[model samples]
Target: METSIRLEQAIKKLYIAFHNNHLNPECCKQCAVGNILDNKDSWKHLSDHHGSLELNYVGKVHESFGRKFNGYSPLELLKIEAIFLKACGYQLPFHHKNSKPKNPTHKDILFDGLTEVITFLCELDDVTNIMDYTKLFEFKNDKPLHDITEASA
Candidate 1:
């Protein structure tokens, strides 16, 4: 099967399974509290003048970046993104049960950001070894698998 089709199918199954009821959170309070960590002032401070802080262990490094967001460097942007991802339960320490999967034990289901998942999966597959990029991105040269069939070459 084409990578795009397979990806879509896999994602559909994942969502269907999740919707049927299968996953749950490992740490409700931690995840929830982390969700709204906007107020830096209330956080446990770590730095001096800059007043930097640690959001979630080593996974996130929140810093002032010395200027406004527009002035953020590449490294600083990376740091900010990392913190947000961890806070949003992306690279979570534990597996949460899906409250809506057919197979409640199936934790592979994800409801948001298939592109990110596809990208990560491609990485985990070790891109150098993947001859079939078609089966990785779940898209055919940027277009979807179904669209490929529906449209002509």
Candidate 2:
């Protein structure tokens, strides 16, 4: 399926980060949006608090002007980070009192976060979730509803 250049690039970066063990929920420079932005923590300045959906003054101005970092708006970046953090088991607006996974860097934990982020990215691009496998289980008359080749198309 066709995807925006930004989406494709973002996905590629995320995939690499995931496999390279560079993804971390607590680090602004290594989170999902961070990797998409080339591991920069500058996006953190767009919001006053980490994992917050609300935008600050700078973020508002950038959003109003249609500014995009690595092809994502300031708001989109915030949403992506929030999603990642939540999926990784962190409470919103990350803080010392917030509950989080005991092993934040665990592969399974990171994978869960990556799954959600990829789903969101696909939604933004109006494409099917690349990580979805339910179609392979669909059946009609006890036969596979989607052939492997057709599903891959």
Candidate 3:
């Protein structure tokens, strides 16, 4: 399957968000989920998996969907966002609260989300055969660290 530019951008943004949250959680307070919900310009290129289904109201309409949280943490919101994004065919994964992590830490939530994003990208590249391996290396070596989660200008 030929990958779309939109998907490519989305995947890159996911990576950017993951590193941003990992390196500076304070700056990226909301992380990827916050970026998805609050920033329309950045995420508008990505398409929804379920057409006409409002993300905010998904739990209300679908019995399988989890209920909304009034004051959820950034990690919790990220998991919910992953669920909806995955349902929309983005290859994302929702980390259920039930799963037991091996090594628990204050940053465990961010790490879990990062793992999902990387897995999604790897699977996407395997299917589409479009990933540039060197770009990741370049990103690691050449890209200056920044607090902003958005891709380098």
* Model 2 misplaced regions, further than 4 Å: 149-153
**Among all candidates shown, the one with the greatest TM-score:** 2
Model 1: per-residue Cα lDDT over 17-116, one tens digit each = 3465422222221111111122123232222211122233322343433332233322332333333234334452223441223432333423232234
Let me know the TM-score candidate 2 reaches against the reference structure: 0.95
Which parts of model 3 are misplaced by more than 4 Å?
A: 22-29, 36-108, 118-153
Q: List all candidate RMSDs to the true structure.
A: 14.1, 1.5, 12.7
Residue 26 in candidate 2, Cα distance off native in Å: 0.8
Overall lDDT per candidate, in order of appearance: 0.33, 0.94, 0.40
Higher-lDDT candidate among 2 and 3?
A: 2
Alpha-carbon lDDT of model 1: 0.33
TM-score of each: 0.24, 0.95, 0.31
Residue pairs clashing in model 3 are: 49-88
lDDT of 3 by residue, 17-69 (tens): 55654322222234444443433322211223221123333333332344333
lDDT of 3: 0.40
